[model samples]
Target: MPDPERDIASRYREHTGRKRTYILTGFVLLVVTAVLSIAVGSVDIPPQDVVRTLAGYSVSTNWDNIIWNVRLPQVLTAIVAGAGLAVTGMVMQSILRNPLGSPFTLGISNAAAFGAAFSVIILGAGSTSSRVGDAVTINNPYTTTIMAFLFAMLVTAVILAFSRFRGTSPEVMILVGVAMGSLFTAGTMFLQYFADDVQLAAMVFWTFGDTARASWEELGLISAVVAASVIYFTFNRWKYNAIDAGDETAKGLGVNVEKVRLVGMMFASIVTAIIVAFLGVIGFVGLICPHMARRIVGDDHRFLISGSIITGSLLLLSADTAARIMMQPYQLPVAVLTSFLGAPTFIYLILKGRRI
Candidate 1:
């Protein structure tokens, strides 16, 4: 007989090599996209100038200001937020053993929206300026961000507590999320109804996801949270893989399914909440990227997680860039573009019967 064991080993190595290549390709594409995003804004700087600026060479002061002060922050935000949301989606799907588990689906986004609206309306943190042609201004962005974060966390706490105290299944927790999302949406509408025109405009503007709002300090905070969460998921990748096999199988493999699930959910929720508080509701990247990565990298969390991070970053950054340059001086919200891009793809996946 032929050497069957040797053949198996060869096949395994080939498979691993292929996955690595895919990840490498994703990284390369992400780099190109980031460069294009930084270069092709209203004041289209040449690629060489863009590279020189990044390499600490002196471009013109105007070019330097546009690159460093305006476009670079948004590009960095897109990368971080995209990776954060996608990885968070991956963790939620793995822990819950549900294909549809994401921050958008779990009501976390809605809760954050409600909180921001509360700050704008009841807290009087939102106003409009006649001098700037009635441009909506958040009088206290910190208060709105804080309120959004707290409300998002509150929803997570409720879901965890119900699961722990009531001994409900992951499916039940999802149902609870649906209920919570509806309630928050109603609450947002309630506040909107009683608000004056200025406050209403401000509230509406806050919900439209835009990366330009984040400054260097805000980006630093988002980066820190996302970096820590990614590290945690990387360390616990094996446990997530075991859990994916089933709770009973995971327990036999010495994985604490309940504890791991709860902790993982909490971390994922925190990542989603922070992103939403800053960027508004950029949906579909989380829901779509994990599935796309799994199709390419298989169910192994090691490759799957890395794949998701790259895919998510590329997708969101590309969308944001398109939004910026499509209409020239007038920019559309990145969130609108994402929803438009994501909805059709999502429906197609469902039509193809993508089950977890």
Candidate 2:
């Protein structure tokens, strides 16, 4: 005779164990990929030397400078940016109950781009040099970052305001986001049309999603915000889990649907704004990483968030590494590599009738 309760408990334990294993494996891979990113760059440094330099050992002045002054910062930026975007995407999808919801899909990226463009073109904030490569090496990045953050918040405000009257239906919210995105994109193009060559070059570089622009100061700010947001999300994981079961069910479970949606949107918007403002507009990581996470860990927000963070960090670190080495002395935009990688997978998912 089978002990049904005992059998059920055994299966539950197995399921939980599998999820933990997936998260642990994914995190280990993320660390390895980060190490590889630090080592494999335009100027190759051995993995051992890279580790030594990081630990405050003198591995030649030039090697130290390259590792400490350049590669390490970029690696940190990619890891943080990837984790932030991936988590934001997961939150957006959960709240909207739409598989396609992302910062890019919601037009938040376009809003950030417009803000950067406004800072460069109208405010005369960034470098006016004719050199495209020097665009990321701007003297006053704070102005551009502030502008991007403001505009991103503006977009969030618009969506929330509209949702008040129309109700927060998934289709309605997505449509509103698409419309907002198109408007912001058009505004960016308009700014570019009247800009001078130097300003135009700077604006163009700002849109390429390069991580080499990261400085220690910017990384610190981003780290603080992302850490806070992730903590908040973690605490509310059960609420999100309830919400994921649909609004009516969530309400029945005593979840405040509107409150959660509002707070989640604001938090996600802030994370997206900070990352896009600094790294330009890296797409696909936000949109695809969540789906990848869900596929691996199922719909449990606890495991899903952890998996998304690890997977996102891995994907961005790998893409950035490819961008650095693929063109030798000349680096391709990290955005280009991510797009190339993401587009194929995206199309394949759609064609295979995967739930996206």
Candidate 3:
């Protein structure tokens, strides 16, 4: 008869190997779905048209413009935002040792929203009807976006500062993050209340977050940032897992827990800023993806980070596609669809924590 312990170990090894295979499969799926995303739309462009357009071949001018200028940006935006948020979620969960720990947990999104709020409401200037003499006013979307990113870091810094002087207990961190989130969100609500109708409209769209404003320029900027972040986190995967074993153990094992936490938080904040600035605040993703990934990959960041990223990217892209197709002429907000799907999953995870 087969030894039971050896059989069990063999089965565990097989399961681990199987997860790695699924991860590779997921990457393939992400690429195929992304290509499909480019092809399926109101003006259905064939696969050849997509390839030829990339090769600078002549197509209908309008179709080419739509393909190169519109769909490409949306595709890239979704990809980067998905990947960045997934890695951020993984890092946060690892650091805090809590599955629910995310950029949202630290109130970073609320702070970013507050910054966007100030830019829209506090800086709303009257549009002069150019009666041949009046100069046009141009608001910088990039600047407002930069503000959102910076404010996220600012909130993170404050949290770190508070945590620095005091011992870092999980409960203390959670309480602080909750309090800060409440304060920033309250501030945002106040700004929204006094916002002019036009400004309010802009903020409402942003708060809900669609890819309506995604353009090639923003895509290029956001992609570069996301790529850099992925490289950093990707190479440092082992450090993330070390933190989960606690700081002292991490230190004895040659991991600089404080430095890792600090660097991890910085990269995590940067990812949050870029995604929010580019896609608006897409929620429940940063909260859920990491846990699901760990559950699948067994808490190894080396595989878990990559798995979470692939799974997260697929989840968002599929959601975005559904949003586009489901509403016909009008597209639903990407954030809305994600939250709808993500909330139930998050709740189930909470219920399933014991199993984890």
Candidate 4:
């Protein structure tokens, strides 16, 4: 007969080794993609010069300015935003126990878009007008961002309020999200109807989810929020694991299922709102990255969350890099690329009968 002790030890070793390998591979890919994203913009900088510039070595003034002022900030924004969205998605799916649950599914993005539209159309924020011979002038650049954040929080508040009474039922939450999403989308359309050409254009552009719009200051804020959210999620990893196994089971294990779900939803919503407010509605990163990470790291939250972060960063950076080069002088929306990439993977998973 086989030795039971040796068999257990061997399996444990294999499991731990695989998890480490996944994490290491993800980290390497993230670094490589970040470097490529910084170097391969409209104004190409060589890989070596990109490294030298980052290390505080003197390069040409123009190259240094381009790397420091333009590309690096954009790349970092993509990285952080991607990681945030992915983690938030994982939390949402786990807490809600729904395969399709995501920040978008919760209607946060739609609400943010409505808020942005309201700012542009009603508040006359981010509006530009040109006289027959005059140049266009933009007014109230921060208005859309502030409005988006506020509106997103409002939606989250509403959801949480309903959940408080409904007892965190996944079906209830999903239905509430769908209803809220419809309401917000209708509101956005109403605003668009009243918008002028310039205001309409501004609203449309804001929804494209471009990382190029993020300033260093904005990136700094995003970094802080994402870091805090990640830390919170990490601390609550065991709670999430329990929550994922079904609420009754979790309750039997002495987990406060309702409270954990409510708190997780709030954190996920806030992180999602921050990203959407800054970058507009970048979808599917949250939906797809979590599933990808789950496949790689399995259901354990400790490895799964880290894997999601790294995979998300790698996916978004690669997509953004492709967006930059695909059109040469003109760039496409990173959201478009992500949707195109994610949709197929989603369908394949469904067809394969994989448990998402």
Taking the tens digit of each residue's C-alpha lDDT, what string does model 1 give over 1-356? 54577778788888899999999999999988888889997788998888899899978999999999999899999999999999999998988889888867679999999999999988889987754322787899999999999999999988988898866468867888899999999999999999998889999989988887799999999999999999999999999999889989999999988888888888998999999998888989999988888878988998998999998998889999999888766788899899999989888766874653
| lDDT comparing candidate 4 with the true structure | 0.86
Which number leads on lDDT? Answer: 1
Itemize residue pairs with steric clashes in candidate 1: none
Which of the predicted structures, 1 or 3, would earn the higher TM-score when compared with the native? 1
**What CA RMSD would candidate 1 show?**
2.2
Candidate 1, backbone clash total:
0
TM-score winner between 1 and 4, please give it: 1
| Per-residue lDDT of candidate 3, residues 1-356 (tens digit) | 55576768787788778888979998999988887887877778887778678778967898888887877777767777777788788887887778778768888888888877777777762232333311222256766687778888788788778778775555656677788889989998999899776677666666676665677777777778777877888887888777777777778889877667667777787778777876688987777777777777778877888888887788778888788778776677789999999989888987987664
TM-score of 1: 0.95
lDDT assessment of candidate 3? 0.76
Question: How high is the CA lDDT of each candidate model?
Answer: 0.89, 0.86, 0.76, 0.86
What TM-score does candidate 3 get on C-alpha atoms? 0.87
Candidate achieving higher lDDT, 1 or 3: 1
- RMSD of every prediction: 2.2, 2.5, 4.5, 2.9
2 against 4, candidate with superior lDDT? 4
Where does candidate 3 clash, by residue pair?
none
TM-score of predicted structure 2: 0.92
